[model samples]
Each structure stands twice: as C-alpha cells, then as structure tokens.
Target chain A: MLFTIAWRNIWRNKRRTLIVLSSVVVGVVALIMNDSLSIGMIRQMFENQLGSHVAHMQIHKRGFNDNKVIQSVVPDQKRVEEALRSTPEVKYFSRRVVTFGLVSSAINSSGAAIIGVEPDREPNITIIKKSIIEGRYLSGASHEVVIGKKMADKLSVGIGDKIVGMASTVSGAVGSDMFRVVGIFRTVSSEFDKSYVFISLGNAQEMLELGKDVSEFAIILRDRGLVEMVKSKIAARLGANYEVLSYADLMPLILAQMQMYKESMFIVYIIIGLALIFGIINATLMSVFERMQEFGVLMAIGMKNSRLFYMIMLEALVIGVLGTVVGMVVGLAMYLPLSAYGIDLSMFSESLTSFGVGSTIYPVLTLQSIVGILIVIPVFAVLGALYPALKAIRLEPVSAIRYV
Target chain B: MNIIEIKDVEKTYHDNGVPVHALRGVTMTVERGEFLVIAGPSGSGKTTLLNVLGALDTPTKGKVYLEGEDLSTKSRNEIASIRLHKLGFVFQAYNLIPVLSALENIEFTMMLRGIPEKERHERAMALMEELDIAELADKRPNEMSGGQQQRVAVARAMVNDPSIILADEPTANLDTKTGANLLDLMQRMNEEKNLTFVFSSHDPQVI
Candidate 1:
C-alpha cells in the first residue's frame, strides 16, 4: 500500500513531478557522461603509452635508469634475450641504445636523443611507422635515420637529406656519424617530438663505437595487467644482477597524476548529487505541508504515523531510484563513444598536446563507476527525506485539519 | 463500562503572546455502543475535546483515558495503534487521498493493520458493496459527486469494523439533501453493525 500510494502520489501533479524527476535525470546523465569520457580517454592514453612508448616491461643493467652510461649496457645479450623469449608474454622483444646527440643539416642543428633500434623488431615494440608523417620505415643494411618532425623542421631537412649526428661516447670519446634522413614522424608527446630520433640499431651501435652492446631490451606483452607479475617473475629468474621496471614504475608521475584527477572528479560528482537530493527533499516536504488535511484525515481514520512516515519515504525512494536508473541508461549511451572517442580537442591539438592531454579526450564506462552512481543517488535521496519525515510525525491533528 | 473517560482536562493555545483556553476543566464519560454528539460553535472547545479524545492531541493539563489506559504514557506510535485497532473517524470534505480510488481508500486502514492485500481487498469490497458505492469503487475522489463521495467515506469509516466511529462535521460540505442521505446511511450502518457513533455537528437529526 505504501508503494502503491507513493507511486500514485507522484502522478498527482504530473507537471511538478516531471520537473523534479527531469532534474534528477539531468544530473545522472551528466555524471555518467563525465565518467565515461574520463575513463575512455585515460584507457586510450594508457594503451598508447604502453604499446608505443614504454612497452609492458623493460630489463636493465643495475642503475641504468638513473645513470645512462655506456658501461650500463646489459653484459649477457645472448642469455638475456633467450630468457625474455622463454615467457609467453614475450610477444615482441627488441633492444634500444640511446644517447644525446646533435643532428645538423648544415643550415641548423638541434639537440636530440638518438635511439638505436633493430630494423626488424623496432616497429613491433614502438609505433614508429604509424607516426611517420612522411617517408618509409627503416630498411636493414641502409645507414638511414628517422628524425622527429620538430627536429626535421628545425634542421630544415627532409627525406633524402644528408644529416650528421654528433655525440660524446660513454667512454668520453667524441663520436660523429653521417646518415640520410629517411623519415620524419609525429609523436603524441611534445617531449618526443622535440628530442627523439630513431635509427637502425646496427648503425647506432657502430656510430657510438659500442661492440654489439645494447642499453636495454624493451618488451611487449599480451595483457598490461600482468606487467608487475611479469617483471617480478623475470627478476626472480634473472637474479639481482638485472633490474626490471614496469610501465607504471617507469612513469610514476603520470600514473599518480591520473589517479589524483580521477579522485577530484569523484568529489565534483558528489557535490552535484548532494544538491539534487536537497531539491527532492524540499519538494516532498512542501507537498506534505500542502496535503496536511489529507494526513489529518488519514490519522483520524486509524492510519498510524509510522504508516504515514513509510508512505512519505517511499515516495522519495521512487523518485530517487527511477531518476538514477533512467539517468544511468541515458548517460552510458553517451559515455561509450564520448569516453572512447573523446570530445575532439583537435582544434587546439598543438596547445593541448604541449600540456600533456591528447588532441581527442574520450569518455569511458566501467561497471564499478555505474554502481557508484547507483549507490550515491539513493543515499542522497534518503538523506533528503530526514527532516520532512520528522515534520510529518510532529504536526498537530486539529491545526493540520484546519489547514486548507 | 464507559469507553472514554476525561478527568479535569484543560486545553490551551497561545494566540500570539497571550494564552487562550479552548477547554476549561471539562469532564465527560461515555459508554460503549452509545451514539454521542458534542456540538458547539467554532473555537468553543468542541474540536479540542474531540482531538484529545481521539488520541491525536494531548491536553495541556489533566488526563484522558481510552478503555482505562492513560493516554499520556503511551508513545505516539502506541496512540496511533490504539486509534487504528479500536477507533474510526470520518470527516467533512470527503478527505480521501486523491491518489487512491474509493476502494483503495477503504483498504487503507486494514493496510495499516498489516493485513495482506487479498484479505484487505475482500473486506473493502464487501463494505463498499454494502454502502451501495461498489459500482463507483474504482473512481478517484474527483470523479464522484458530493453524495457518492460521502457514501464512500462512510464505507471507509466502517470498513475496519472498529468499536467506535468519530465523524467531525461529516456532512459539512454536502447539500442539505446529500447531507441528510449521508447521515441516514451512517445511522443505518449504526443500527445494522451495532457500531458506536461519535460525531460533532449542529444537525438536530445527527445529535
């Protein structure tokens, strides 16, 4: 009876009820859209960072990340490469030899990190080819190099232009190598654009005067969730001499920043939900006051105050539940594409990428997030009912009956 | 045995700063199954006494007992349960919940008793059938005329089969003929069910 009465009571004034419920629906939809978009963008960023930049895990000689010295190269390349391939997670494994150098095309010169990669395995790990705005990927046996778009622009070089790379070797010897600028590529990260230059690993090794030595073996895996576990297993198998770092371990600052942003967004959602619940509570209280004569009659006809209290609360719950369910449904529909596809910030791509956000920001959806909205809305609704229920029980029979 | 006992009940209200007395040391006793009428002009303590007797209000001073239990010590919920199980009330203006149809209004009291729907529906339809408003059972309050609505109200009042039915100017909103017919239906219910009738009115026939 309580539910029956409460349901009917909502439609008692269809226009007023519609106004109240529509507000709730709007709040819910807005929250869902925001949540989905945030999730989707972050997921895409994580994937891009993992597959194109960091890979799942890396094995380094002790102290390599902190001190990138020439002597930091892994000593046993044959054994390390074999051990890495022994695991099923080893979808692609390659070596990268990195050093700071100046690339000059006679007209200009700019400082850059020259990354040596195997022609056969580099594309399997980093998305270098897809990023190529012009020219072709590395061809084995050619002393060709790929420079970042920014580097190419600064140096005034294009595909087929001769460029000279100069760097100091880890052994304190000045090293210089000449190469053809075979490709120019765009990177999502501004830092990558300003500093990164990719070349065939054999050429980099020869130029740096390193005898078949590699700085580290970068690896890709089937699932990113296993990054930590894989790192640990590799560490256990390889012993203390070798160190392993997962993507998060390599980029702690980015991961922490993302986590903080997510938490702050949740706070914003809570504030919105709280305000909506206040509107619901106030409306119900006003209606109760307006319907005092009815309550008085109900009380006179043997309707217990408890029953009356239940009736009032049921009405609130109905609005809460109905609004939340509908809102989530509508919101998720928008969330999926908005989060995954992101609201295109392409209009300001350069400005946004410089600030770390990509050109497109997508919205994402998750079950846990949907459940959170479900839990929060009803709690807010019930919280809104507290004062009104107290008022209903305390109203006087004679005076309330006299109320028109 | 008397069903109601009021002892030295004094009721007052604050009209702005000065206190106004609605009932002054009033006393009354009434037996079961008796038709009692308390009539007075507005603000003459009639409704005030009725509110106290109905356990919907407490006297400013003194005590009220229903079936020999003190009204003071019982909790608000206890008072409501007492009202539900042992008393029934009818009022002017139909006073039906606009949301519920006439049949639902009659089942409302039984619902408060925690009776299941099937039993409550059966009892409601049976009473509404007796009042000759069964044909209008599904109609909301606005759909029925003044006379039909009053008859439905009477059916709701008697549906619980309680010891007493209190009507506070039950015919105040109806035309004279509709009022007369409404009162006749209540009087007939009083005779057939041996129901106790307690009402406040200026009508000589009702008194």
Candidate 2:
C-alpha cells in the first residue's frame, strides 16, 4: 500500500517529477555517450600499436631486451621456430635482426634504428608494407632498404638511390654497406617515420657478421585474445633461455598512457555523479517538505518514522530506474548507428596522431560500461534521498501538523 | 480507570527570542468511556493541552500519564507504538493522504500495524458503511466533499479501536448541520463501543 502511495505521490506534482526525470535522463545519456567515445578512442590506440609495431607477443634472449647488441641474438632460432610452429595459437611469427646505424645519402645523413626482416614474413607481422607510398617493399636478400618517408626526406634520397649504412659487427669491427632505397612508408606517427629503417634479414646478418642468429621473434595470433595462452606455452617450451613478453609488457609507456586517460575520465564521472546527487536531493527534498502535513497525520496515526523514510527512498528508486531506462534507450538510439559508421575526426588528425590514435573512431559500448551506469544511477539516487529522508524522519508530528 | 492524566502541565514557545506561553499550569484527567469537550477561545491553549495529553508534545514542567504510563519516560519510537495502538487522532483539516482513496485512508492505521489485507478490508468497509460513506470508498480526499472527508477521518481514527480518540476541531471545515451530524456520529460510537472521546473546539455548536 505504501508502495502504491509512493508511486502515485511522485505523479502528484507532474512538473516537478518530470523536471527531475529529464535532468537524470539527459545526464545519463551524456555520460553514456562520453564513455562510449572514450572506449572507442582507447581501443583504437591499442589496435594501432599492436597492429603496426607491437605484435601480440615477442620472444627474445634472456638479456637481449636490456641491450640490443648483435651478440644478444637468440642462441637457438631453429628451436624457437619449431616450438612456435607446434603451438596452435600462433598464426604467424617473424624473425628480425635489430640494430641502430647511421645511413648517409650524398646530400645528407641521419641516425636510424634499423630492423632486418624477411620480406614475406614481415608482411604477416606488421601493416608497414601496406603503408608504403613511394616504392615497392624489399623482396629478397639484396642490399635493398625500406626507409620511412620522413627519413628519406631528411637524407634527400628517393627510391633507386644508394645510401651507405654503417654499424659495428658482433666482432667489434666497424662494417659499412651500400643499400638502394626500395620503399618509403609513412605511419601515423611522424616521429617513428623519421627514425626507423628496414632491410632484408639476410643482408643485415651478413653486414653485421651474424651467422643465422636473429635478434627476436614477433608472433601474431589467430585471435588476439589467445595471446596469453600462446605466450605461456612458448615460455614453457623454451624455458629460461628466452624471455616471453606480451604486448603490455613490451610497451609500458602505452599502458601508462591508457591509465592516464582512465584517471582523467574517472574525474569526469565523479563530477557528473555529484551533479546528479544535488539535482535528485533538491527534487526529493521539495517533495518531502511539500507533503509535511500529510506525513504528520501518518505519524500521528501510528506510521513509524522509519517507514516514512523508506517510502521516500522508494520514490527515489522509481525515479532512478525510470530515468535510467529512458536514458539508456536514447543513448542506444544515438550510439548504435554511430558505432557502425564511425565518427570522422580528421579535422583533429594532427592532435590525434600525437596521442597515437587514428583519425576516424568507431564508438563501442561495452557491457561493463552499461552495467556501471545502471549501478551508478541508483546509488546516486539513494545518496540524493538521504538528506530529505533524514529530514522527513526528524519531523515532529505535532509541529508538522501545524505546518502551513 | 483513568485513560489520561495531566498534572500541572506547562507549554511555552519561543518565537524569535520572545517567549509566548501557550499553556500555564493546568491539571486535567478523564476516565475511560468518558466523552469530554475542552472549550476555549482562540489562543486559550485548548489544542496545546490536548497535544500534551496525546503525547505529541512533552509538558515543559510537568508530567502526562496515558493509561498509567508516563509519556516522558518513553522513547520516541515507544511513544509512536503507544499512539498507534492506544490513541487515535482527528485533525481540523481532514489530513487524509490525498493520494489514498477513502477506504485506503481508513485502512492505513491497521496496515501500519501489519494487519492482513482481507481482515482490514472488511473492517474498513464495515466502518465506512456505519459512517454512511461506503459509496465514497473509492473517492480520493480531494474528490470528496468536506463533510465526507471528515467522516473518513473519523473512521480512520476509530479503525484501530484505540483506548481514546482525540478530535481537534474535526468539524471546523463543515457546515452546522454536517458538524452536528459528525458530533452525533461520534457520540453514538462513543456510547455503542464504550470508548473514551476527547475534543477541543471553540464553536458553540460543537460545544
């Protein structure tokens, strides 16, 4: 009966309840949209990094990560490859010999981190070949280099032009090789484009005097979700000779960047939650005091103050659930199509690239985010009702009956 | 047996630092099955005296005992339980929960006591029939006339079969004929049920 009374009481002043409901609905819709967009952008950052550079997992020699010298190459490449091939989770793996060297053209010179890869295997590991703009990707064990566009521009070199690459070999001797630029690629990050240059693994091994020894293995999985199981299986098969690391371990900096975004977004949610608290508190308090005399009569006849308090809370629950449902409907109406087509942020491409995200983003609403909002609305409603419910319970029946 | 006892009760109000004494030293008592009228002009403390006797307010300097229990010794919740089971109150305005129908308003006190729906429903209907407001059972307070709402208030007060019923200006909102009719109804219930009735009114017609 009290529940029925509470439900009907909310509609007693239609304007007041509507105003509160609209505020809650609008607030929830805005919050859901904000959450979806943030999730989309964060997802893009992870995909871009994993797809372009960091594969799902990497295998290296125990101390190879601390120091990237030619002597730190994987002690036994054939063993690692055989184990990886046996693992069903690993769809693709690439062998690479990495080093830093100075490449000089006739007109200019700049320092570059050089990666030596098998042309066929490299394509399966990264999307760099697809990003090539100027020329063809490296084909075989020729003295051919695929440099970034920024690096080619800095060195004033183009495809079919010769550039001298100089580095120290495993024997502690300086080695120099002449290479023709075969491709120039541009990734989302201009800084990466300016510093990374790639050559065939055989050419790199010969120039650096490393015999069939590769720096690391980059593995791509059939499903990215299988990364952990694959990493663990590979680690168990290879033992302590090699260190296995997931993408998160391989890129601590990116993980920190994601954490920073989540922290700032948490602050935004807090601000929105506080606003909801105040709006609900104001509306419920008004209703409670407006019916002060009626409540007085109820108390005088023997309704406990606690019962009255709960009735007020029941009203808040109705408002919270109603507003949240309406807000979710409106939010889904706006986000579903937006997720399918994606929002173009090309106008802010420069800023986005600095943060290592793509220009166009597809908003994704996760189940966790939906459940989070559903939980938050009622909590806020309860918090908002506390003050008014306390005030209602504090009403002296005698004075309340006298209240005009 | 004494149903209510007020001993040298005093009530004072502070209105912005100015003390206004609503009740001076007053003593009163009423036995069970008594029908009494507390007559006074405006500001004469008739309502104040009734409020203190009903345990709605504590006496400033004295004690009020209802059914041989000192109200001052009880906690708020205990007092509320006593009021729920021992006393019924009817106010000047009908004060029915505007959202409830007449039958619901009459059944509200029993519901608070956790009475079963079927039993309370029968009791409320019988009382509504006795009050001649059975046809208005489904009407909300705002949809009913003043006299009809007052009758619902009376039914609500008497629904619990309390030891005592307190009516403060129950007919102030009704016309003379309606007011007399309400008094006669109360008087008949008082005699038939052997229930104690107490009222405060300045109207000569009610007196």
Candidate 3:
C-alpha cells in the first residue's frame, strides 16, 4: 500500500514528474555517450599504433629501442626466428633493416626513417598494405620503395618517380642509393606519415651494408590476448641479449593518456550527476510542499514519520529506476548502430590524424560503465530526496493541516 | 472509563516575533463511548483544543493524557504509535489521500497498523457496504461527491476500531442534508460500537 501510494503520488502532477524524469534521462544518456566515445577513441588509438607499424610485439637488439642506430643490429637473428616459428601464438613476423636517413627528389629533400622490409612478410605485420592511398605496396622488386603521403609530398615525388636515399652503414660510412617510389601511404598518425619510408629488405640491407643482420623482428600474434605470453616465450628463448617488448611497453605515453582520459570521465559523470541531484531535489521539494495538507492528514491518522520518509524516498527510487532503464534502452538504441558502423569524422580528418586517431570512430560500451550508471543514478536520486523526506517528517500535523 | 484527559492545556503560536494564543488554560475530559462536541466560532480554538485532545499537538503548559499515559512526555514515534492504534481522525476537507481510491483510503489506517491485506480488504468492504458506499469503493476522492468522500473518510476513521474519533468540522464542506446524514452516521457508530466521538465545529446542527 505504501509502495502503491508513493508510486501514485509521483504521477499526481504528471508534468512535474516527467520533467524531472526527462532531466535524469538526458543526464544518463549523455554520460553513456560521452563515456563510450572516450573509450572508442582510446581503443582506436591503441589499435592504430599496433596495426600501423608496432605490431603486437617486437624483438630488438639491446639498446636499439632507446637509440636507433645502424650499429645495434639484432645479435641473434637465427634464435629469434626459431623461437617465433616454434611459438604457436605467433601468427606472423617480419624482419626489418631500420635506419635514419635523408630522401631527396629533384625538387626537395627531407629526413626519414628509411626502413627496409620484406615485402611479403611486412604486409602481414603492419597496415602499410591497406593504408596505400596511391600507387601500390612494396613488390620485392629491386630499387622499389613505398613512402608515406606526407613524405612523398615533402620530397615532391610520386609513383614511378626516382628518389635518392642516404644512410650510415655499419662501418661508419655513408651508404646511399636511388630507388623508384612504388607507393604513397597514409596512416592514422600524420607525424609517422611525414617521417617514415619503406624499401625492400634486400635493397635496404645492401644499401646499409648489413649482411644477414636485421635491426628488429616485428611479431603479430594470432590472438592479441597472448601478446605477453608470446613475448615472454620468445624472450626466454633468445635470453637477455635480445629485448622483446610488447606494444604497451613500446608506447607508454599513449597508454598513459588513455588512462588519464578514462579517469577524467568519472569527473564528468559526477558533474552530470550533481546537476541531476539538484533537479530531483527541487522537483521533490515542490511535490512535498504542494501536498502539505495531505501529509498532515496522513500524520493525524497515525502514519509514522518514518513511514512518510520511506514513502518519499520510495517515490524517488521509482523515478530513478524508471529513468535509468529508459535512458539505458535509448542510449543502447543509439549506441548499437554507431558501434557497428562507427561515427564518421571525415570532415575533421586532418585534426583526427594529427591526434593519431582515424577519421571513423566506433563507440564501445563496457560492463563497468553500465554497472556504474545502475548504481550511481538511483543512489543520487535517493540522496536528492533526503532533504524533502526529512522536511515532510518534521512538519507538525496541527500546523500542516491548517497550511494553505 | 475516561479515554482522554486534559489539565490546564495552553497553546501559543509565534507569528513572526509576536505571540498569538490559540489555546489557554483549558481543561477537558471525555469518557469512553461518549459523543461530545467542542463548538465555537472560527478562531475560538475549537480545532486547537481537538488537536490537543487527539495527540496531534502537545499542550504548552499542561498535561494531556490518553488512557493514563502522559502524551507530552512520550517521544514523537511513541505518540505516532499511540495515534495509529488508539485514535482516528476525520478532517473537514475529506482529506482522503487523493491518490488512493475510496476503499484504499478506508483501508489505509489498518494498513498502517500492519494488518494483513486480505483482512483489511474485507473490513474495508464491510464498512463501505454498511455506509451504502460500496458502489463508490473504486472511486478516488476527486471522483466522488463531497458527501461520498466524507462517508469514505468516516469509514476510514472507524476501520481500525480506534478508541476515539476526532472530527474537526467533518461536515463543513457538505450540504445541510449531507451534514445531518454524516452526524447521524457518527451517532449510530457511537451507540452501536461504543466508540467515543469528539467533534469540533461551529455548525448549529453539530452544537
């Protein structure tokens, strides 16, 4: 009966109830959408870094990651290959000859990381094959090269154009070669596009004069969840001489930013929740005051102050539950299709790429986010009702009955 | 046996900084099964005295007792319990919870007493039938006429079989015929169930 009364009391003023409910619903939906977008952006950035060039894990010679030099070539290439081949989790691996150099066309020149990749193996480890906006990926053809769109633009070179690449060899000599640009690729990171160029492994090895020695082995796992296991296994096989690192270890700054964004989302939720709290408090207080005479009659008829308090609290709870459920349903309705096809931000592609994010973003809804809303919204609603409930219970029946 | 006793009761209200005396040095008592009227014009403290008698307000300078227990000394919760179990009320405005139907309003006091749903429903139906309001049981207070709503309020007051029913101008909003009918219904209940009735009104019929 108390439940029935509380439930019916809310609808006594339908417009007021709905207005308050709408505020809560809007708050919930906004929180869900905001959280999902942030998660999606972070997830996309993480995946882009891995797919562009980082792969799932990498095996480098000691001190190579900290200081990329021609001298720090992989010490035990055969052992690393053997371990990768033996590990069932290793889906694909590519050996690269990496060096910093200058690429020059007839019109311009720019500094670049002149990477030498095995054409067939590199495509499986990185997104360079799919990222080709013009021309084609490396074909293992001698003197063939693939440069990023920004780099090609800076060098004023295009497909079939000849460009000269210069780098230091292992013997402290400047090794330089001329190559034809076979491809121009663009990735999520504009900075990466502006500075990296790819050529055939054999051409790069000969140009850098590193015989049978590679700079690093980039490994992609069949299941990304096994990245740590695969890295540990390969590291154990190659011993301490070879440094095996996962994508997380290789990109600490990006991961840290992702963490920071997630933490900041809680503050956003708090702000929204606080706004809803005030709204609920105002609406409930009005309802309570409007029915002062009725409440007085209830008190005179022997209804306990505690019962009256519970009744008001129960009304807020009903509103909270109803608002949350409807909001989640509506939010999910909006989220489902957006998550599937993603929200296209192509108009802001340049800015997105500069931030290392793709033009299209897919929103992700997590179990933790859903659970947090379920707990938080109702708790806030109840909190908002506290003052009004106390006020109702404190009213003297004799005076309240006479309240105009 | 006396169901209520009041000794030198006083009630004063502070409007802004000035004091207004609503009740002063009033003494009263009513025996069980008694049908009594506290009649006076408006602002004569008739309702105030009834409020004191009903345990809805504490006397400013006197002791008000219900069945030998001093109400002023009891905690607020204890007073509420006493009201729930021992006293009933009918207000001038019909004051049925607008959200509840006539039958629900009648059953509300019993529900507060933690009575089982089936028993309260049965009792509410029986009382509604006795009042010739069984047909309007499903109607809300707003859906019913003033007389019908007052009957439901009377039924609500009697549902729990309280020791005393405190009515503050219960028929103020009703027509004369309706007012007379309501008084006759209360008179019958007082005679039949030995229920004590306390009425505060300026109506000559009630006086």
Candidate 4:
C-alpha cells in the first residue's frame, strides 16, 4: 500500500516529477560518465607515458639508481634476466643503460636524455614502436637514433639528418660521434615528447663506454595491478644486490603532479553533489508543507501518521532511482564517445605536458566509479527527503484539519 | 454498544488575535445502526464537532471513546488501525485521488490492509453497481462530473462495510436531485446493513 501510494502520487503531477527527475538524471549521468572517463584517460596516460613503456616495475643496482651513471651498472645481469624470465608474472623483461649527452644537429644543438635499449626486446615490452608519428622506428644496433617530436623541432632535426653525441665514454675518453636520425615520434605528454631520445644498446654502449653493463632492468607484467607484488618478490629474491622500484617509485614528481589534479577533480565532484542534495531537499520540504491538509485528511480517516512518513520517504526513493537510471544512461552516452576519441587537448599541450597529463586522454570506466556514484546518490536523496517526511508525520491532525 | 462517545468536547482556535470556539463543550453519543444528522448554521461548530467525532482532530480539551477504548490512550498507528477497519468517510468534494479511477478509489482502504486484488475488485464492483455508478468506475475524478463522482465516493465509503460512515457536507457540491439521490442511497445502506450513519451539514438537502 505504501509503495502503491508513492508510485501513484508520482504521476499526479507528471510535469513536476519529470523536471525533478531530469535534473537528477543530468547530475547523476554527467557524474558517472565523467568519473569513468577521467580515470581511464589518466590510467592510459600513465601506462603509455610511464608504466607500459617503462615497465610497471623496475629493478636497479641497490645504490646505483641514486647515482645513475655508466659505472653504477648492475653487474649480475645474467642472473636477474633469468630470474625475471622464470617468474610467471613477468611477460617482458629488458635491461636499460641511460645517460645525459649533448647532441648537435647541423643548424641547432641541445642537451637530451638518451635511453639505450636492445633493439630486439624493446618492441616486445613497450608501446614505443606504435607511437612513431613520423619516420621509421629503430631497425638494429647502429649510429642510428630516434628523436622526440619536440626535440626534432627544437634542434631542426628530422629523419635522414645527422647529429653528434658528445659524452664521456667508459674508458674515460671524451667520446664524440655523429649518429643519423631514423625517426621522430610524439607521445601524449608534451614533456616526454619534448625531452626524450632513443638509441641502440650497442651504439650507446660503445659511445658511453658501458662494457657489458646496463644500469636498470625494466619488466612489463601481464597485469598492472600486480606491480607491487612483482616488485616485492623481485626485490626479495635479488636481496642486497638490486633495488626493485615500481613506476610509482621511479617517477615521484610525475605521480605527485597527477595526484594533485585528482584532488581538484574530487573537490568539483563534491560541489556538484552538494548542489544536487540541496535541490532535492528544497523540493521535498515544499512538497511536505504543501500537503499538510492532505496528511490531515488521511489521519482523519484513521490512517496512521507513520504510514504517511513511509509514503513521503518512498517518494524520495522513487525520485532517486528514476533519476539515477536516467542519468547513468545519459552520462554514459556522453562519456563513451569522449572516452573513445578523447577530447583533443592539443591546444594546451605545453602546459599539460608540464603537469604530466597527456594532451589526449581517453576516459576509462571502472566498476568502483559506478558503484560509488550509485551508493552515495540514493543515500543523499533519502537524506534530503528526511526533513519533509518528518514534517508530514509531525503535523497535528486537529490543527491541519482547521485549514481544510 | 455506543459506537462513539464524545464528552464535554471543547475546541478553540485563535484567528488574528481573536478567540473562536468551534466546539463549545458539546457532548454527543452515537449508537450502532443509528442514522444521525447533525445540523447547524455556518459557525455553529457542526463541522468542528464532526471532525472530533471522526478522530480527524483532537479537541482543545475533552475525551473521545470509541468502542470502549479511550482514543487518547491509543498510539497514532492504533488510531489509524481503528479507522482503517471501522470508519468510512464521504466529503462534499468527493476527494478521490485525482490519478486513480473510481474503482481504484473504492478499493484504496482495502489495499491499505493488503487485501487481495480479486476480492477487493469483486466487492468494489458490487458497491458501484448498487449505487448505479458502475459505468463511471473506470473514470478518474477529473473525468467524472460532480454527481457521478459523489456517487462513486458514496460507493467507495460503502465498499469497506465499516462500522460507521461519516459524511461532511456530502451534498454541498451536488445538485438537488443528485444530493437527494445520494442521501437516499445512504439511508438504504444504513437500513439494509444496520450500519451507523453520521453527517454534519449546513445544506438543507443534506439534512
């Protein structure tokens, strides 16, 4: 009977109920879709910009990561490589030898961070090959190189162009050699595209004088969620010889920046929720006060005030569920398209890159986001209905009857 | 048994700083199978007295006893239970839920008590047919005329077969013929079912 009354009353003023339901739907849908999209996009940016390319987890020489030089290379590479291969979670594992060097093109010159990687295993572990926006990816070990899109523009360099590498070789000689640019690629994040350059492990080893030694061991896991577990096991097995750092540990600065952006988005979500709650509260309060005479009549006919209370609360429940269903559909309709192609933020490339967020981010929908939005929304709507339900129950049948 | 007892019931209201006594220490008793017409001119406290007797309002100061139980001692829900099982009401405006059809309005209290749909439907249909409003049962309040709606309301009141039926200005919104016909039907239900009928009205036709 309570459910019937609530359902019937909703249709009494169809237009009024629609207006409220539409607002609720709009709020809920926008919230659900937006929440899903943003999370997915950020995850994509990190996996592409950091985790996938760099491996969700990495292993390093215990003290070598802090110093980061050719001399600090972890010597027991064969053992570490075999251990990573043997682990079921490890899908791809490779060694990295990194250093800073000055590269001079014909017309311009700039200092760039060079990543030396094995040509064979690089494509298997990272998305670096697919992101090549221009020219061909690296072919084999040679004096050939691939420069970032921004670096190419800044140095007036392109495919078929020659550049000079000036750095200390392992033999303590100032090594200088000219290398040809094989490709130029741009990733989603501007900072990465602007500063990063790639070269073959053999060429880097010869030029940087790293003899049979690499400083970092990168691993791509079958599941990104297993990063911490993989890192812990790898670290424990390697003992005092190596340090295993998750991508989170390797790039503290970028992670911190992304965390800050998330905090701001959370604040905005709260404001929207608060405004919606207020609207519902106002609507329900007015509805209760307006129906005092009706409630009095019900009581007059031997209807219980408690039943009236249930009736009012059920009305809110109806509104909340109706709005949530409508909103989820609408919000998803908007979000799916945006998440697929992503809103092009190319215009703000420089600033976004500086903030460590990709210029193009496709939003990802997760179960947690949907559940969180649904659970919190109904509770809030019901809470908003509280005042009105209480007010209806508190009406003195005699006093209200006087008005009737 | 005296189905309803009102003792020294006094009800007062203040209107714009002036005291108005809607019911002035009036006492009344209603017995089973009684057909009582409570009549007074406007402001004579007839509606106020009816409101108290119907348990729609508590008197400013007084006691109301229903079927040997002090209504004041009952919880609000208990009072509602009594009303659900034992009382029926008809008003001048009919007051049918605008969204419900005539048949649904008649079955509403039974629905409140969780009565099965088939039994309720059978009873509601019979009641409407008896009042000759059977064809209008499918019409909503707005779709039906004043006369048709009043008949439906009376049918709704009778469908519950409650211990008592209270009518407040039942004829105020109806034409002479419609009002007379509705009153005659109530008189028949009172006589046939041995039902108690109480009405408060200023309209001569209702009296």
| Most lDDT-accurate candidate | 3
For DockQ, the strongest prediction is 3
lDDT of 1 by residue, A1-404 (tens): 77888898888878878877888888888778777766666665666667556887888887898887766888788878878889887788899887888888889888888888888888889888888989988887667998878788888999999999888776779788899988888876665777878888888888888879988899888877788888888888888778788888887876886798689778977788788878988788887888888887777766767778878888888888998988887887777666555588788888756644578876666787788889888778777877787788677666677777
Off by over 4 Å in 3: none
TM-score of each: 0.95, 0.92, 0.97, 0.91
The candidates, ranked best first by lDDT, are 3, 2, 1, 4
User: What's the true lDDT of residue A72 in model 4?
Assistant: 72
DockQ versus reference, model 3: 0.89
Clashing pairs in 3: none
**TM-score of candidate 4 against the unseen true structure:** 0.91
C-alpha RMSD by candidate, in order: 1.9, 2.7, 1.5, 2.9
| lDDT of all predictions | 0.81, 0.89, 0.91, 0.79
> What ranges in model 4 sit over 4 Å off?
A105-109, A167-177, A223-229, A251-269, A285-291, A353-359, A401-404
What is the number of residue pairs that collide in model 4? Answer: 5
**Model 3: per-residue lDDT, tens digit, B46-87?**
888988999998878899989999898898889889988999
TM value for model 1: 0.95
Q: In Å, what is the interface RMSD of model 2?
A: 0.7
CAPRI rating of model 2: medium
Worst 10 residues of 2 chain B by lDDT: B50-59
The list of candidate 2 runs beyond 4 A from truth reads A102-111, A132-136, A141-144, A147-168, A171-190, A259-266
| Per-candidate TM-score, chain A | 0.93, 0.91, 0.96, 0.90
- Model 3, A192-217: lDDT tens digits are 89999999999999999998889999
